[model samples]
Target: MLFPASGHTKAHVLHYYAQIAPVMLPHVAGRPASFVRAPEGPEGESWIAKNPPPGVPDWVPLVPVEHRDGVTEQVVVDSTAALAAMVNLGAYEVHVPQWTAAGGRDAHDRLVLDLDPGPGADLVVCCRVAERLRQLLDEDGLMACPVVSGSKGLHLYAPVEAVSGRGASAYAKGLAERMTVEHPRLVVASMAKLERRGRVLIDWSQNASAKTTAAPYTVRLREGSPGVAAPVTWDEVAACRAPSDLAFTPEAVVERAAERGDLLAGLLGEGVRGRVP
Candidate 1:
């Protein structure tokens, strides 16, 4: 099995991406994605040469790299318009972030919901939670996707325009509290570690770029192979019963998605309500 990536060398970091991204790029069809090399990242061309990813083209600009409490993140982002630029650059390379932080981007005000089934959560039950989350967002017309944590949980993502006048923090906090209030066992927003032990911790902290969450497609050090970390539709998400049980690769996710179709699409229309405030 693949060992957690050694953070020792920029080359080692780039090597894995060079080897892995080709298999993963197809799933990220609508986002602007790029890689950043540590230490050297903020300097200049040194970062690019030290960790030159396999397929990224020539046009992508060198971004400032970020290192967080637990992981080292290359300051790359994926977005609808950015994805187009990445293709224009050269290689649509992938990355495995050791520490991730978010802040400078316009991603603020966007909502993120972490659907965690506490320790020893039954896969069947967790899948049900995933299904329910999908429904809730769908009913509200919010954009959301499902992701499997390297450990025993899953996460749901919802995007709101932070620019809509509501700060990302307020919008995310209110929604998290509301979910816990409405579905006590399904979502928990408290910081008490004890409460999170056996329940799915609904985390909405990613509203700030400074807050870090695991990105899809990258393997968690202790976790095994990182599977297709792309966005899935509500139908696909609703049907999932513990996606962790299955092996993931960008190719596999794409193949599966084609056969099954995405479930979250119709939910992102205008007029999503209940602002953070």
Candidate 2:
């Protein structure tokens, strides 16, 4: 079983990934990806893998990512078979950077802001913060889309005219700082735990070249029910009265994708590209 407590097995994980692959692959395909592996299930030890582990099939592509120390070969899940291989390795959670391997390493095609709720705060507060962020992004000529992170909080993504990773980070950080100053009670830009109490943190650091966020449609390795980082509509975000409203299961996500298609597909288009300024 991959999720022992929840009674979900490795087969379940593979099936979910297979069903979601078509819509999911485009978003993650050229990105340097990382995986959170729970070999003995969620209750057992789990680790993050940036480099491919041994025994990976030859068909899977390993993209090289350069760090200050050296270059690490990161796995890129470009096809359904590759995604299945990741699942077989006990990875339920996939994390990827804003920039893709196909695009220049330093060039970011999107800007992401992770809305993290601190103690005394919950998804309801996160929804409020997201709405405000959507407004801010809209004013900046960027169209923002919301994805319920499944673990906690939400993530906001906007398509941008290829900007440098540093530039994306600076733009996101500036927005967060501005929001914190304007809405001190509701938002906290600082990463400090004490300051974030009862507030939602606009985590802008994920835009850094090396940082990663849970890819949309990734299944989070959490307790209780399986939660998929499902993309959501603005209407759904506004209507999120309870956390359960946004919390989606793997089965639910497959069905939702069938009906709504990829809610974030607009981010892939060249049209409506927003400037970092």
Candidate 3:
């Protein structure tokens, strides 16, 4: 079992990824991936793997990524088989940078802001913050999509013209800082935990070139229940009254995909893309 508390087995994880591959692959396909693996399950020892794990087949695609220390060839989940291979290796979560390998390491085409609720705050609070953020992005001529993170938070994604990773990071950081100034009681941009109490943290740092956010449609290994980081609509975001309202299971996400199709499909099209300024 990959999650002893939730009674989820490795087969369950593989099935979810395979089923979500069609919509999920477009967001992650050309991006270098990092995996959070728990061979002993969620409660057991888990590690992040940037490079391909031992025993991965030769057919899996590997792309070289250069870090400050050195270069490592990271796995790219470009196909269903490639994704399943990662799951079979005990990966419960897949993370990828905002930039893609095909666009080069510095070329960032997406902007992501992770809305994290601190002490005394919850998903309800996050929903309020997300609405304000949507307005801010709208003023900036960018349209943002909300995704329930499946682990006590929400993520906002927007498609922008290809810019340097540093450029994207700067824009996001500025927006986050502005939110804190305009709405002190509702938002906090600082990373310090103490300052986060009673407010939501606008985590703009995820846009950094080296950082990764949980890919959309990936399962989270939260205790008691496993949650899928599922895409949501603006109407649903406004309708979230409790944490459970936004929390989605893997099975539920698969059903949603079949019924509503990809809610964030606009991010993939060229016509909807915008610039940071």
> How high a TM-score does candidate 3 get?
0.98
Candidate 1: tens digits of C-alpha lDDT, residues 116-228? 66665554455576676666766666655666554456666565544321265555667668777887865678867778765667666655544545445443333233333
TM-score of 1: 0.57
Residue-wise C-alpha lDDT for candidate 3, range 1-277, written one tens digit per residue: 7666667788888898999999999989999999988787777888988988998889999999999989989999999999998888887799999999989867888999999999999998999999999999999889899999989999999998898888998999999999999999989999999999999999998888999999998888776778889999999999999999998888899999999999889878888789987
Shift in Å, residue 235, candidate 3: 0.3
Clashing pairs in 2: none
* Model 3 steric clash pairs: none
Q: What do the candidate models score in CA lDDT, each in turn?
A: 0.47, 0.90, 0.90
Among all windows of ten consecutive residues in candidate 1, which has the lowest summed lDDT? 41-50
Q: Mark the regions of model 1 whose C-alpha exceeds 4 Å error after superposition.
A: 1-60, 64-74, 77-109, 164-166, 223-230, 241-251, 257-277
State TM-scores per candidate: 0.57, 0.98, 0.98
RMSD of 2: 1.0
Q: List candidate 3 stretches off by more than 4 Å.
A: none
